[model samples]
Target: MKILFATSEAHPLIKTGGLADVSGSLPSALAHYKHKVRLVLPAYRAVMERLPEKSLKQVAKLSVGGCGREFEAVIWQLKAGAVPGVDVPVWLVDIPALFDRPGNPYLAEDGADWWDNGERFGVFSKVVAELAMDRAGLQWQPDVVHVNDWQTGLVSALLSVETQRPKTVFTVHNMAYPGNFPHSLFAQLQLPESLWNLDGVEFWGHFSMLKAGLICSDWVTTVSPTYAKEICYPEYAYGFEGVLQKRAAEGRLIGILNGIDEHIWNPEVDELIHSRYSAEKGRVAGKQRNKAFLIEELALLNGLSETRIQGHLADWLQAPLIGFVGRLVEQKGIDLVLEVLPELIEQTPANFVFVGSGHKSFENALRDLAQRYPERMWVYIGYSETLAHQVEAGADMFLMPSRFEPCGLNQMYSLAYGTPPIVHHTGGLADTVVNATDENMLAGTATGFVFYDPSRFALKSTLLHALGLFAKKRSWQKLQKTGMQQAFGWKASAQRYLALYVED
Candidate 1:
């Protein structure tokens, strides 16, 4: 089957989250099974810069725009060979006025969303829909059109109107950000006026492009099985639970857990870390060396003036090396971390390191806390790809106290690197990490630590519990081995997607 994988971002070329990783890797995984998969993304300035000039070949000039002013979309082709053995074709939709801006694709320099996003992505989606219809001035049409997140959600809706259109699949990576726009955009989006009703694309008083996918697509999916069930509730759905609930009733709503690129994430081959090891050999010592490097780099051995710092130097030295990597935003439960950091410090002398930055208030608070307890707490503001790899390989316990995670790649990466994760019981975090309780440990089914409630006390208690288990070296290694042995790779996930695509 020929599948057109449409997304707003893709790995290596452009990325803001796990969506890019999926878009980049899954196509290649599908190609390995003899399915022709074409991955498509907008030719944002960053994407063009990331690819070599020789790799891009102009395919066609798609006509797209709104308000009677047609824009020429110079479609270019490149092959993404990062996934090995199978090279997947990557289609770049080039429209300078819409995609040539500088910073992140979705945000401006001042960190506000682009005012013209609805129009920008609408044109992109229309062109993609046309391509699915074999109308992009190209000879090929996909057997199935797979769209991801709200950014490409309207492609399903746009394809629905045609008499003979490819089967459409839209995967909701996150339900919180509904692609909603003022009803005033009905004409500007060039959408048919008839689609403005509640049963079509309307949500409350706005036009929700994302809902159009849920209501119109042949099948709808989310990142994880747990998240798929979560979105049916009013809390996680953000306002579209009814639409998802209706789809669920029809047996069209489904969930598939995400997978990571093991080749890039494996500790043995990753050169970013201070030391490398495989699950079968030198896992313990290798991780300890990397942890020492991280400790020195983050200055975790300094500032002993505080009595709390000097009291547990031995425990802090041999204690659970906890790490957090992601945006310091409320959704990630960074707020919960800030609330319980003091109590957690007082409760246990476990070493902690945080990487990634978000929201000025969280950054400021984390920086202050790190300053106060240099021995126990350390933080690196902003994201570094190399540092992320090092942290995953080095840390003994990874932290993902997210309020909701559609699907997280870090926890999977950590497991592959023999690092157990401590996560909240929500979304993909709940799906991937099996809590290492006494009973689960005895049953040999435990992988990591899990806490249900997103409260400060709950997180603090979980950390202490993990620390107690960490002191027992054999139990800690058992949990690490269990997590490392689980396979969360693209091959399995791609096969499931293949079944979905070719099914009647």
Candidate 2:
């Protein structure tokens, strides 16, 4: 089958989150199965700069119409994987006026959303629709067009009106940001007037791109089985509960769990960490060396006072090293981590390292708390890809206390790296991480620590439990090896998607 994967961002060229990771990995997985797949995304300035002059080949030049004007764009193709055997063909929609920006694809320099995002993505979607309809002069058409998130939502709606069009699949990564605009902007974009009613893109006097995707597409999917069910209720749906409920009733809604890119995340051949080790060999000593190097590399103990600094390096290496990597925000439950860290630090010998950036309040609070317990805590305010890999490989335990997650990749990364994760029981976290209850532990099926309640007390209690277990060498290694042996690769996921595409 020929498939067109349309997304707003992809890894290596550009990335802001897990969407890029999926966009880059899934297409390669599909191509490995001998299916022709072309991944499409907008050509932001950063993306253009990331590509080599030799790699990009201009495929077509066309005039795209949107927001009351004719915008010129060029379609260019490039191969998108650094690994030897995995190469994905990528198409870039290059429109200077709309996509030639420096920092974020959707944000301005002052941290506000770009004012013309409605027109920008609408024009991009127009180009995508043309390509899917075989009108872009490429002489190649896909049997299926898979669109993701609100950025490419309009493609499904645009293709719905055509008498001869490919099947459309719209996957929602998150339900919080629903690309909504004023009703007046709909006329400005010159969209078909027939689509302005309740059954189409209309949502309570606004033009909603997300609604169009959900209502117009033939099939709808989300990241995980649990999130698929969560979005049908008022708490997680954000306002589209009725639409998803209907889609579910008609058997058009699916919940496919996401898989990680094993090529990039595996510990055996990864070049970023201090020592490379597999779950089968040198797992213990290799982790010890990496943890010691990471602690020294980040100066995790430099903040300690004279008396605290006197501990031997071997002692610090023996203590548990906990890791947190992701945005510091309320949704990630960073506030809960902050609330309980003081008590944890005062009562235990465990050390902590936080890596990532987000809301100002959360950043400031993390900084202040690190200052109070310089010996026990270390913090990095921004993201570093190398540091992320090191944390996954070096830390004895990883923390991902999200209040809700569509599908999380870091916990999977942690599992693959032999680091058991401590997570809240929600969304993909519930689907992926089996709790370390006595029954599961006896069965040798426990992979991580899971807390049921969404509060600081639960997190603290869970952390203490994990710390206690860490002292039991036999039990802890059982959990680590069990997690490492699980399969979280994309081959099975791609097959499931192929089934969706060819099914009657």
Candidate 3:
């Protein structure tokens, strides 16, 4: 099947969150299965900066919207052989007025999303719809036009208006970020009012890109099975639960858990960390060296004594390194983690390392904890890809105490790196991390720890239990090995998507 994935961000070229990773990885995975998978993304300034001079291939110049202005779209093709056998073609839609002027793709230096974001991505969606209509003279028409998040959500709606339509699949990475604009922007989008009705684009007297995709797409999918179910409820829905519930009633809404690219996450091959290790040969010694290096790095940054180093290492090994790597936002339960920090430090000997930036309150709280407990806590107040790898490698346990997780890649990456995760029982966290119990036995299939309640006490108690279990080196090793051995690749996910594309 020929598939066209329309997303706002993709990895290696551009990234902000897990969406980029999926945008970059999934297409390549599908391409490996011999599916002609192509990606369409905005050619923002950052994207142009990263593109090689030779990679730019001019496709065509076309007029969009009623403004009658012609925009030049140069296609930047990212071939599969760049990443070993993974060959997928990435098409960059370059329109300077819409995308070139940017600090971040979505935000300005003032830390606000561009006011014209609705117009910008609306043009992108229109471009993608035209590409699908003509197939750009390719041998095959796209079997599925998979749209991600709200940025490209209008692609489904635009395709719905087309005469030659491909089956559309809309994947909501997060429901919180609804792409809403005034109804007046509808005309600027070149869309007719026929689409602005209860069963169409209208959302609470506003035009919502997400709502258009959800209502018009043939199938609606979220990142995880648990998140798919949660978004149909009032609490997690973010005001779109009614629409999702209606879709569910009509049997159009579905869920498929996300998987990570294990090739990039393999500890044995990754060169960013202090030591390289795998589950088979260098598990114990490699982990010990990694822990020692982490302690040394933390000590150098915060001034810790040798005694503190020994204590930290002993604690890390005695318990487990429950790691947290993501934005410090309320959705991630950063506040809950803060509330439990003092008690967690007192009760558990686990070493914690947090790597992310967001929410001033959580950042300040984490920094304060690092200052107070310099030995046990290490906090990096920004995103770092290299440091993230080290955390996945050095830590024995990965922590994702999120209130709602769409489809967390860090936990998947941690598991791939032989680190068992302890996550909140919500969304993708609930789908991926299974609770350690006698009935499941885990024997050789356990990946991580999971907790149900979204409270400080529950999080603290779960951490304690994970740490207590870590003292049993045999069980800990077994869990780590099990997690490492499990396959969470994109092949199955791609096949599931293929089925969704062909679904009538």
Candidate 4:
């Protein structure tokens, strides 16, 4: 099958969140299965810097939204060697006016999202839709146009306008971030007024790219099975429950758990960390070395004494190194984690390492907590790919107490690296992490801990439970082996996606 993946971000080039990871990994996974896959992403400044000079090929100029604004798009062919036998062609939509700039792709200097995000992504979607219709002129055509999140949601909307359209698959990585714009901006999108209706792009009197994709796409899928069910409820729906429920009633909505790229996550082969270890040979010693290295690094960075560092590691090692790697925002349950920290520290000798940046209030709170308990806590206020891998591999336990996780990759990575995850039983977390129970004799099959409620008490109690189990070396080792053995590969996911594309 010839597949075209339209996304706002892709990894190893430009990334902001999990969407980029998916966009980068999934196509490569599909290509490995011998499917002809092509990816389209905006050529941001970062992408330009990273791309090889020769890989870029000049593609035709694209005119979007009837705005008479032409942008020159370059096609960068990602060969088998580029992604290791994942022969996928990656086309970058280069338009300096919209995508070319400094800093993060989504945020401005003041940390506010670019106000023109709606228009920016809308233009990219229109270009993709246009490209799909022109087979003879283009390098490759698509049987399936897979659009990710709200950024490329408008592609499905645009496809609906054409009679000869390819099968469309819309994957909702997260529904919280709908591409909504004022009703007046409809004219700027150059969409027909007929599309701005209850059954079309209209969402609460606003033009919603997400709504349009949900309504018009051939199939709708979320990241995980539990998330698929959760989105149909009022609390988790983010105002789209009715639409999702309606789609499910029509048998068009489904869920497929996401998989991480194991090639990039293998601890034994990864060069980014201080030490390397495999689950079979070096699990214990490698983890100890990693713990020591982390402690030394943190102490050096923060100018703490050797005694302070030793105390921190002792606390960290007594139970297990429970780690959190993500944005420090309310959605991630940072506030809940903070509220439960003191109780957790008192109940268990677990050390905490947080690596991420978001929300000024949350960042300050984490910083203050790190200062107060420097011996038991470490915080890094930035995103680092290498550091994230170290956290996944080195930590005995990974924490993702998110209020909602559309399709978390870190949890999967943790499983791969023999680090059991303790996550809130919601969305993708519930779908992926099997809650340990006596009935299941979960010792050898358990991957991580899970809590039901999104509260401080629930989180703290769950951590305590995990710490108790960690005290038992045999049980903990069994849990680690079970997690490492679990398969969350993309082959099954890709097959499910192929089925969705073929569905009527």
Q: Pick the candidate with the highest lDDT.
A: 2
TM-score of 2: 0.97
**TM-score for all models, in order of appearance:** 0.95, 0.97, 0.94, 0.94
Clash totals, every prediction: 0, 0, 3, 1
Which segments of model 1 are wrong by more than 4 Å? 82-86, 300-316
lDDT tens readout by residue for model 3, 1-504: 889999999887788999988887888877877778888888889878865677566655555663345565555555555434335777778778889896788899877889889888888888888777764444446878999998988889878877768899999999989999998788666686679898888988898999988989989998998889989999888788889999999999999888787678888888888888887989888877776676566566666777767665665555556678899998888898889887778776666788899988889988898999887788888889987888888877788888888888888888778788888988988877767765454455567788889898888888887877788888878888877787788888978887788889
Candidate 3 ranges with C-alpha deviation above 4 Å? 66-72, 76-86, 135-140, 303-319, 442-445
lDDT of each: 0.85, 0.89, 0.81, 0.81
Give the top-scoring candidate (TM-score): 2
Write one digit per residue (lDDT tens) for candidate 2, span 1-504.
899999999776778888888887888888889999999999999988866788788999899887778998899888655324337788999999999987798888787899999999988988999999999899989999999999999999999998789999999988988999998778888888989998999999999999989999999999899999999999999989999999999999998888898878998888899999999998998889888777766654345444444455677788999999999988899999999988999899999989999999999998898888766678888888899999999899999999999988999999999999999998889999998989999999999999999899999999999999999999999999999999999988889999999875
Pitting candidate 1 against candidate 4, the one with the higher lDDT is: 1
Off by more than 4 A, model 2: 80-86, 300-312
Structure candidate 1, residue pairs in collision: none
